[model samples]
Target chain A: MTKRKMFLRMITASLLRRRSRMLIALLSIAVGATILSGLVTIYIDVPRQMGAQFRSYGANMIILPGEEGSLTGAVLEEAMQVIPSENIVGATPYRYVRLDMPSRQQSFTTAGTDFDEVRKTSPYFSVEGEYPQNRREIMVGKEVAETIGVRLGSSIELSYKPLASFEGEASADWVPGAALLGSSEGFNEAVLNVSAVLDEEGKISEIEVDALSQTENIGSLVGTDKAFLDQFLGKSLPLTLGEDVDALSGATISSQAVVDALNSSRSRENARLSENKEHYTVAGILSTGGEEEAYIYMSLEDLTRLTQEEIMDVAELSVSASAEELEGYAANIQEEYPALTARLVKRLAKSEASVLSKLQALVFLVTAVVLALTLICVSTTMMAVVSERRREIGLRKALGASDGSIRHEFLGEGMFLGGLGGLLGGLLGFAFAQMVSVHVFGSSITFQPLLLPITIIVSMAISAVSCQLPIKKAVAIDPAIVLKGE
Target chain B: MALLELKNISKIYGDLKALDNVSIRVEKGEWVAIMGPSGSGKSTMMNIIGCMDKPTMGEVLLSGVDISKETARSLTDIRRDKIGLIFQQFHMVTYLTAVENVMVSQYYHSMPDEEEALEALGRVGLRDRARHLPSQLSGGEQQRVCVARALINHPELILADEPTGNLDETNENIVLGLFRQLHNEGTTLIVVTHDPEVAEAAQRTIVLEHGRVAREVINENFGK
Candidate 1:
């Protein structure tokens, strides 16, 4: 037989002779390896799973107007383009406006937002009925509906006077410039400089009008137009021609033409003021127990049409990413768009990070404790084996066995046990991790293929280190004394 | 030149002297016996001669190489090359079979040869029991296995310390007969024992008393 074969035979026989003791050591090593593999898997994957779980709570980030003091739909779209789409769960832009209720003599705050985006960003908000589907439909909060004395399907009339400079005073007239009028044949242009004077209570106290028509026959009636425009004095806006004002005498078509010009000028001015008066049906009641319960919500499309501007005050975003990654995205957005401020909701981000880190720390601590205990247990068992074999060691030494050879035998037994236990533990550990993940996190963990080799190497290292003290004790045996029956 | 020499060997254990001013010599192919009472330093002298230990002060020249000054590692090499030891307790590895036990010695000395190891066991009349563990063998059979293991490497000196002490009279005679056969084959033998019959089989006997060589006797009836 070869020396190597003989050596292996000797070590194997020795281990087999003390099967019970060696079995204990093997079990300890296996348990240690199991914990090592399982906990490491958890520590690496917890952040991703926890980040996803936390995203369900609400939006953890908000984008607001920067130094420009105003945000637009185009700017929000541009900012969203820079972020990866997969990371974004939802991003909803919000626009706020206040409209007066003429009959109630009160103003109600209103917010315009996309309902589809809100479902993702603010899943916690519950609507009593349903979100508005059209411009004529609106959703009011519980407090808004209570204050307005309106229910689902009830109509609300809201109005807002034109706040532009041309509304209350004769600052300018609708000239259309000479080129625009002259470009079209048979088109008569008129300049109507109309102004309303309001009292302290916002009631129209007086009205004035100056009309100049480019039509050839209408130029001579400047004195007569004073009487014609005087009929509108002391009247309130949203006035209708022929209903609120008397028609001029004799020249009926000419009078109708002047009235048409007046109505066209007012329509152009009202576009900037955004529909001075409108009626809407209350489609839903929002019952959120927060500030949102006191405001009226509508579609952004309708709000844009009314305000004649595509602008938003702020945008709320829900992203599926860790706090650090969100910070990186926020930094990138701010750098790219100086007029936009991206902020993370610190409470949610910090809580998610804190919980995940603590869980990882706990896993690490448990793994460390298990490994230490395994080392101690295996070391003690090996020491006992060495003690039991003192006479055998002495006999070998007397038979001209070197200290190095004696050490080799004991180390060989230990490493062999370690390798066997490591393989068993690798398979068991993955199952252990899978069970824990499914039970605790309600999700299945991804298997890491690299951990198998790592576990085997670590087990072998533990076994080799555990053998050092026992090997030392074995090598210190004195053949003369031990063999002499002393 | 003497094949083995110990000049003024002294072995001290703290305040007690196990061997003091002891000197002995044996020529090549000589069979000698050492007889002594307990605490007479017989085992201590044997230990030093077998390279298991070093004397406190002495020069042990085996084949003209002073081994007293050798390092522990060098002593192991010298022991494997030139000396073979048989213990009184028959200290065979309990797990290995008889043949494997013999092969262990050959393994440390050089490459193990199972055929050679089985032949060695055959010489000791243990060929039939070659596959039995030490626990399965009787006292005399276990002792024979030890003898086979010691003789497997063809060492220059065979050191047997009370080799038949644990055996019955019949088994003892069997072991003594094996020692005589080996001696006839020109192999050196050193027997440490308290039995007069065992001592009488040797060419000469050295008796120790209280750590010193008190006397030496020659066997009168030779070769006949």
Candidate 2:
């Protein structure tokens, strides 16, 4: 037989002769390997699992208007594109405005948002009824509903009156501007300078008019006509000559021309600030114990139609990722859309990171303790075996075996046991990790195939190191004394 | 030239001298016996001669090489190449069978040859018991296996220390007969023993007392 085959045979025989002692060493190694494999698996998978759990709390990121005064739909879309879609749970945009309820003599802060995205970003919002479904429907906060004495299914009228800021000023030169002139038959033909201003209550505070060019008869009544326009001041918008004020008695065409020109100029000043009055049903009552309870919420589509403007003040996002990853995404968003500022909600991000880090540290400590104990136990058992085989070692040395060969035999036995134990422990460790994951997190874990080989290599290294002291003892045997029955 | 020589060898431990100024020599193909009482340094002298140890002072020349000055590693190689040892306890590896026990020596010396190991065992009349463990064999059978193991490497010298001390009368005769056969084949033999019958079987006898050689005697009887 070959020397290698003979060496293998000798060690195998030696190990089998002392099976009971070797079993204890094998068990220790397997247990250590199991804990090492299981804890490493848990350590790698914790962040992803915990990140998903933290998402249920609320949005952890927000995008607000940057240098621009407000955000637009294009900016929101660009921010969403910068963040990976798979990591985004929700992205909701909001716009706020204040409108008056003349019947109650009070104005309420109104918020325009998407209800579909609100379900993901603001899951804590509890509505008494339901979100607004149409332009004629709106949701009122609990504080607003109680103060206004409105319940579900009740109707409330909201009005937006345009300010009477003038488009064309009446200068002393009395030069009429064509762009400010309206399409009335006599109005377009005449050259008239008109100017107006509104008070905080949207009432016409001041009025001025100059008839630059007109018929000789009407031009003669210009001084009298200026005094007639004063009666229209202190009146609300959409004023009519017949309803709001009396017409000039003898110059009816000039009186119609003056009134039409002033109204046309108001329309050109602020297109969105027209006389908007709409009745909407109270669809839902929000009862959040925060600032959200003092406002009215409605769909963005409906708000856009009412105000004739499409914009958002801020966007809230619920993204499932670690704090560092969230920071990277925020950086990307700011780089791509400089007009938007992205920020993380530090309270939620810090708490998630803190809990995840502590858990990983605990697992690492436990694994280290287990491996140390295994090393001590295996070393002790191997020392006992070496003690028992003192005579055999002496005999081998006497038969011309070198110290190097004796050491090789003992180390080979230990490594072989380690390799076998590690393979068994690797399979058992995966199952152990799965059990812990399912029981504690209420979820299953994925298998990591790379851990098996790594576990085996570590196990073999530990076993080889454990054999050092025992092999030293074995090589120190003196054949003359041991064989002499001493 | 002498096949083995130890000139004024002194082995000391602290203040005690185990072997003081011991000198001896054995020619080629000679069967010599060393006889001594307890504490006479018989085992110590055998250990030095077998290359398991080195002397503190003096030269031990085996085939013209001074082994006392050789390093431990060099001594191990020299022992593996030229010396074979037989112990009194028949220290067979308890787990290995008889044939495997013989092959152990062959493995360390060179590549183990099962056929050669079996032939060595057959010469010692253990061919039928080659597969039995040491515990399963009788005292005589185990001793014969040791003999086979010591001869597997075809060493130039055979050093046997009380080889027949643990055997019955019939087993002792069997082992002595094997030694006689090896001696007849021109192999050198050195037997350290307390038995007069074992000493009388050798060609010459050396007696030691108080770590010194007191006398040497040669046998005059013919081979018959």
Model 1: per-residue Cα lDDT over A1-486, one tens digit each: 899999988888877876888889889889888888888877777776676678778888899999875788788888987778988889988887765566774556678899889888888888877888877788899988997799999998765433332253221332322100000011122222334444544334544432222232353242247776676555444346578766665444445544443333332344232236778889999887898988888888877776666888889998888889889889998999998999999999889888987887898889889888888988998999889888988888888889999999888998988887787787788889888888988899888899888888888889899999999999999878544545
lDDT of 1: 0.79
Q: Could you give candidate 2's per-residue lDDT for residues A205-237 as a string of tens digits? A: 766554433343454263246578778667765
- Give each prediction's DockQ, rounded to 2 decimals: 0.59, 0.55
Quality of model 2 by C-alpha lDDT: 0.81
Query: Which residue segments of model 2 deviate by more than 4 Å?
Result: A69-78, A95-310, B125-140, B217-224
lDDT of each: 0.79, 0.81
Docking class of 1: medium
* Alpha-carbon RMSD to native, per candidate: 11.6, 11.4
Task: List clashing residue pairs in candidate 2.
Answer: none
Q: Which window of 10 residues has the lowest lDDT sum in candidate 2 chain A?
A: A172-181
**Model 2's DockQ score:** 0.55
- Candidate 1, clashing residue pairs? none
| Per-residue lDDT of model 2, residues B1-224, tens digit only | 89999999999999888899999999989999999897888888989988889999999999978899998778888888998888888989999999999999999999999999999999999899999999999989999999999888888999999999898999999999999998999889999998888999999999988889989988766265
* C-alpha RMSD of candidate 1: 11.6
TM-score of chain B of 1: 0.97
